[model samples]
Target: MAVLSFDNVSILQEDVPTLQQVNLEMNEGDFAYLIGKTGSGKSTLFRSIYAELPINSGVARVAGYSLNDIKRSDIPFLRRKLGFVFQDFQLLTDRNVEKNLSFVLEATGHSNPDEIRFRIEQVLAQVGMSNAIQKRVHRLSGGEQQRVCIARAILNKPLLLLADEPTGHLDPEVSLEIMQLFKQLNQQGTAILMASHDYNTMRQVPGKLLKIEAGRIFPVNSLD
Candidate 1:
């Protein structure tokens, strides 16, 4: 099944166009990399998928929620089934690793504490962060923190995972490790859509490649 679909999607910020007529798809258990130079609308495209930027035109559906026509109240619910990870590691400053995952579970309506704990452990283990759950966020290294971010994203058992420049701050080896982690998640039936400017890393990862160039989104070879 197609976990995400965008048909003629357009997005603008403050009357300036960032993305234009982007149509893409990432199916279940699929892994695809978003590649482009700076200002190539990579992040803008990712934002449109989760409704961070309202679709100015055309249709976008993520986990069955239409971006062009969706309710304000429905936004939070839409997010529950879609995992979003950032390059900057957006964990709460005051919360420990466990607390961060717990916060998302409670927010998403997982009231049973025991079930939530199990879910958290499951995701952390999936991302190889099971041993670091009790550690504070800052205490972990950059790669470890990113692994924790991945753990939290999958805790909700999302149908799709969207990561934005996931390896921006890591060294080459660490970035490779992070990409492997994403690939592992994809293998386990979680569709992944990641936006990154890391050309080398994107080339290394085994997945289809999509690129944004000159205000258009299409496959890399199409640009030629």
Candidate 2:
């Protein structure tokens, strides 16, 4: 089954339709790039996939759950099947790296201390942040913090990852590093749909391009 499928769907934010008659899909192990100008509806499309923005019409299914019929209580369940990485590196400022990750594991119902610790270690290692496990969020560089965010996102072994300009705040070198990390994850069978404005990064890490323009999405061979 498709990890994400949208068929003739319309997405709305604050009662305003941002994307109309959209049709898209991502299968297991698919890697797709979402690119668009500012306010061109890239984020809106992402929000709709995760149910943060409501679907106004047509069919939308993600990780086996139908967005059109998702209940409030079911939202969390659906989210658990996906990972989200934000550009701001939204780590808990007051917590250390391990604790920040532990908080998510606990919230997601991981109760055994050993298992939680093990999972935390595993994901941190995946993002090459295992050594920074005890570092305070405030002390880490932007790249390290973003690595932590990526580690946190994969803690639950999500089927799909949704990244919103995850390398936006990093330097060129760091951005390349992050893109490599994402590629590694995709190679390991995790489907990824990332929204990025960096056309150079897209060239470096090629994938199916989904471009949003004037609130519509269509495939393109290249940003050029």
Candidate 3:
């Protein structure tokens, strides 16, 4: 089944249309790249999928929820099925890595302390950050911080992962490490839809391409 689908959908930010008549689909275990120039509606489209931005029209479904008709109360449930990684590595600066991750678990209704710790360990291990559990966010390198962000996102075992320029700030070597981590997650049965500006990295780790331009989305035939 498709983890995400948008048919003739329009995305709007603050009542201004950003993408029009967008049609797309992502299936289970599918890994795809969302490529576009800045301000070309890539982030807006991502927001629409996660219901951060309202769908102005048409059919949209993600993680088995109908986005167009989703109620406010249902938004949380919709988000639970999605793991979002952002470019800025939005970790809480004041908290240690474990606390940051624990906050997510607590907010998501995970009350059992033992289970929370086990799950946290599992995700941190997945991202190769098990050793940084007690480190403060300020002390970790940018790549390590991003790994924490990824670990936090996967705490719920989301059906799809939505990443917006996850490697935008790191050096090429660090960026490659993060990409390899993402590829590993995709191989382990999670679908990924990542928005990226680094065309070189896209070429190195090729996948289905969804290119957005002038408020439209279409598949690219080749990276060349």
Candidate 4:
């Protein structure tokens, strides 16, 4: 199965349609860019895949869950298959980077001390933050913090990584570094679907591009 998908899915915010007849699929090892103006349904589509927003019409099968009428109990399972990265770091201010990452792994059922330590080290290495694990959240730079967030997201070795404007708060150089990290993860068969407005970042790297506008999706470019 494709890692993530939308089949004629439509989303509504009260009476307004946020997405219209959307149909798309992202395969394992695939990397794609999703872009549009603000309020153009970029987040609406992303949220729909994670079942954050209920589908008003059509069908969507995401992370192996039938989001059309998914059960509440099924949500946790679905979430485990996806690594969601947000623009905001959302780290625990009171905890160091290691503790913040450790909390999620334990909350998600990684209890072995050896395994937990190994998992933390592995993800940190992936994001080039092996040295920042012991640093307090406030002490790291904005770019480094965001990298930690990405590391936390992938600690479970998720099947798909969904990032919504992952680099919105970083400078160009830091943004490029973050994007390259994502590219590396995708190369290892972790499907990636990123939503962003940075046209230059997407241009330099290679990926399929889907543009969203006025509640619709379009294929503006493809480097597959």
Candidate 5:
């Protein structure tokens, strides 16, 4: 089943054109890397999937919600079916790992404390961050924080994960580790569409490669 589809879609940033006539699709459990230079509209495309930016024309669907026709009140629910990870590790700095994961679970309608706790433990262990459940976000190392971010993103078992430069801030060694983690998640049945410029690491953890260039997205056989 297709979790994300964009057909001849046009996207704008600040009233300026970004991606135009873009068509793309990803099925359940698939992985694809979105590669582009800085300011090539990779993040803009990601935003459109989550309705953070509007699709100016054509059809766009994510996690079964139509971006063009989705209602304002439905946005939050739509997001519940999708996950987002960022380079900057968007965890709440004031909270410990458990609280951060709990916040997502509670906000998403999980009320049973025991179930929530179990789910938290499962995701944290999946990302190899179970031991840091009580550590403050700022106290963890860069890689540890990113692991927590991944943990938080998967709390609700999203159908698709939109990761924008998830390893952009980490060093090569740490970035490779995160890529391996992503591979494990993909193998376990979560579809992932990650925007990255880390060509070496991406090649090591191979997936379908798509490039955004000249206001469009298409497949590329090689990162070069």
Candidate 6:
């Protein structure tokens, strides 16, 4: 099954067309890289996928939710099946790591205390942050914070992960480490569509290539 699909979709930003007649698809467990210049439609496309932006035209579906026809009340449920990671860690800085993660569990309808604790432990261990569960979010280094963000993203066991410049802020070494972590996640069966501006770094990793230019998106064999 396709984790995400867009057929003849057009996306607009403030009445301006950004992506037009876009056709894309990603099957379960697929890994793809979305690359484009700074004013390209990458962000718009991501927003549309998560139902933040309205589909101007055409059929769109993500994780089994129809985008063009998805109701407002169902958006939250649609989001529950998908995870988002941004370049800037979007955690609650005042909260400790455990609090931040547990908040997500509760919000997503996990009520059992034991179940929540087990899920948190499982994700933290998967991201190599099991030891920092009680640490405050503000105290973690950039890499550690990003790891925490990844762990939080996966806490719900999403069918797909949307990452926007996840390594844009880290140093080269740390960025590589994060990329490896993403690779690990992909290998374990979660589909990933990552948007990145750093072509050199992104090209170093192996995945299907996609580029947005001239107000549209299409597959690419290489960055060159």
**lDDT, candidates in the order shown:** 0.86, 0.92, 0.92, 0.87, 0.93, 0.93
Span of 10 residues, lowest total lDDT, candidate 1: 215-224
Per-residue alpha-carbon lDDT of candidate 2 for residues 1-224, written as tens digits (9 for 90 to 100): 59999999998788888999999999989999998898999888888888998889999999999999899999999999999999998889999999999999999989999999999999998999979999999999999999999999999999999999998988988899999999999999999999998778778988999988877889998789
Error of 5 at 150 (Å): 0.3
lDDT per residue for candidate 5 within 95-144, as digits (tens), equals: 99999999999998999999999999999999999899999999999999
Question: Which stretches of model 5 miss by more than 4 angstroms?
Answer: none
Per-residue lDDT over 1-224 for candidate 4, one digit per residue giving the tens place of the 0 to 100 score = 58777878889987788899998898888888998888898888877888889988887887778898999998888888899898988889888999999999999988898889998999999888999889999999999999999999998889999999999998888888889889988888999999988777777776888888877788985533
Backbone collision count in every prediction? 0, 0, 0, 0, 0, 0
lDDT of 3 by residue, 1-224 (tens): 89999999987777788899998999999999988888898878887888888888999999999998899999999999999999999999999999999999999899999999999999999999999999999999999999999999999999999999999999998998899899999999999999998877778887899889989999997766
| Candidate 6 lDDT over residue span 68-91, tens digit each | 889999999999999999999999
lDDT of 4: 0.87
- Please list all clashing residue pairs in model 5, or write none if there are none: none
Q: In candidate 1, which residue ranges exceed 4 Å CA deviation?
A: 221-224
CA deviation > 4 Å runs, candidate 2: none
TM-score of 4: 0.95
The TM-score values for the models, in the order shown, are: 0.94, 0.97, 0.97, 0.95, 0.97, 0.97
Q: Which residue pairs in candidate 3 have backbone atoms (N, alpha carbon, C) closer than 3 angstroms, thus clashing? A: none
Query: After TM-score superposition, what is the CA distance of residue 167 in candidate 5 from its true location, in Å?
Result: 1.1
Candidate 6 whole-model C-alpha lDDT, 0 to 1: 0.93
